[model samples]
Target: MLYSMSFPLSHNDKNKYRYSHHNGDSTCKGIDVHEIFMTKSRVRLLLSHIGILVCLVNCYISLVKDKLCSSSIWKITVIILFAKFMQYKPVKKESLVILPEFGLQLETHYWSGKIARRFVPGGKILRPVLNECVTPFTCYWSLALILHGEDQLMLVFQELKPPLKLLVPIWKALRSSFDVKEGSSA
Candidate 1:
């Protein structure tokens, strides 16, 4: 183990997190040979479509809120797309439930999960990972939004009825897990 000696680095691991390395970053911990080029995980598989949908929703909500008193906003597409591509099933468009104390929770016959992302105080944070049944990576529920007040939550729920219903529970759970204050927000 001297400067004169050499070493060999081999990807004997099948884990996508272990195969590819991104400059000492944990985000690239799992990068399989096949996955390195194009990672098709549940979360990232359809990010392109999700990003577009998020943008469109934001634009629509902004326009409506500008002209009107206020508007409801929902990101059901995130879960629907998540379920369709990741879960291989149709998500219940109307069954989203919100528990202010609990944050947001996605529950159904086919699958159940939360729209959450655990918080990290500082340091290097890895890329977000999509959560399925078995494997949940770091910051699993990274999409949960923290509402400052109850009125804010109600107003949001008004515009978008489907998925925001669950945002509360997801946020609550995440907050509890991360030791966030009840009235605090991200």
Candidate 2:
């Protein structure tokens, strides 16, 4: 009998070493969309979320630590907004591609006409679509914060949460009235 050990590295130890070596600059740049799409485990999803949370933390840190002036901060925020919007665009397209590919992959792998029966909605579809639809409002809220300062920003941010709930309706009404009044006067 022969025993073979691969890499002589325990999984936990390898993970620890990998993480310790990353200095926050190691982003999700190299992650394969197909791998994420194929992963059905909640733990993997949670880990992905954790990575995004880390990036958000880094963004907050840079915003604070740079001690940027108000105007410069606003500009930086706009740039970040654009980057986020663009990042989601490719994801959205990939998601659209995946829906049809999923059917094909399932058909080829299972060799059954019942393959479609096993289909479940995937995050690849939901996340990108939701993000695309929400991007404008997201940009709006962030820009509002940059323009109006933290106190007002908090109020607006809370309103923009979801489904246009909370203060958004009232805010929009006020904005429309304000615009109407301006047009009438002009």
Candidate 3:
């Protein structure tokens, strides 16, 4: 896939600009002045290039060792590219938290090591439909104790309960903790 970007001609200019494209004729669009603001950085551009290379390598490896079909290879490549370059993050874990007190706390985690914590003060847990993961890849989902900052984090969700309306945003943020860091696997 080819990527292109547009930039304003200058601070004083608005409509006139130029676009750079990897392949094909790049055309600049004339939108209202400052309709949307976009900024690019060298690090992000470099990472995008690296992401493409990784996708290619992964596709080749899957094709060689796994003997995956060409279509599957393409699918995997697309997934990797979309994941890495397009900044689409995979949901790592979702959970309902049970605090020590009578109330409860909800937590969400991402592979990027960012934790989303939601606290419901004095929120009583009537009952917990606790589902435990006995082994790795159980139910195609495994539970492993991994150290997260100061806490040992669980990779699987054990409790079943939807957070309250106020906590929904917190859950959403926790689910989206995919903010890629300098050296994250996400």
Candidate 4:
């Protein structure tokens, strides 16, 4: 993107005083004027260029070994261009705290990793009626656990609920019913 600084001056004293500020364009609108004008050492720019060249060389060598040099080259080129474009672009930060908690803490004491709770016996007795409500929530929890960086073993154990384990056939039947309903609606 081109950098152009606009100066707002009165017609009477256009040449007498000069002011420099951002020339807000479609691409550079969000960038701070100070950051764009800040000077960097020549060595930094040279090192960045060398780093990109090294990555490209590695990609090319890997592509040649795979016998997909042409397609891989195109993909790598696009990826590099995209990275450059994003580096130049200013973006707003996203918040991790905004993720939906989905009533995880409120539902059952066992879910919160509380060991003292007698949830297992209750779960075994409540398996039949609770399967419908539990399956969707169980699936949702397993997915959320994965998203929250839990280990694979924890994810497996968390999903091994009495209802979820016993009601696999019932869940499949429900899924088929939904597909039939969707077909009819369409």
Candidates in order: C-alpha RMSD to true structure: 18.8, 23.6, 20.2, 25.3
Better of 1 and 4 by TM-score: 4
What is the full ranking by lDDT, best candidate first? Answer: 3, 4, 1, 2
The predicted structure with the larger TM-score, 1 or 2, is 2
Q: Per-residue CA lDDT of candidate 1, range 68-160, in tens?
A: 333322344443454454432222121223232333333222123322222222122111111222245422212323344322211212211
What local lDDT does model 1 show for residue 25?
29
Q: Please give the CA lDDT of all the candidate structures.
A: 0.30, 0.29, 0.39, 0.31
Q: After superposition, how far is residue 75 of candidate 1 from its true place, in Å?
A: 9.4
- Name the runs in model 4 displaced over 4 angstroms: 1-36, 69-186
lDDT of 2: 0.29
List model 3 lDDT by residue over 1-186, tens digit each. Answer: 233344434452233222222222335221101111123245655776777777777777777787797777677967675756555232344544332333334455554578676654332222222123345533222232232232434332332221122123323333233222434342
Report residue 28 deviation for candidate 3 (angstroms).
Answer: 22
| Model 3 residue 153 lDDT score | 44
Worst 10 residues of 4 by lDDT: 90-99
Looking at candidate 3, what is the lDDT of residue 44? Answer: 53
Model 2 C-alpha lDDT per residue in residues 4-52, reported as the tens digit of each score: 2123335443331110011112453221112001213356456656655
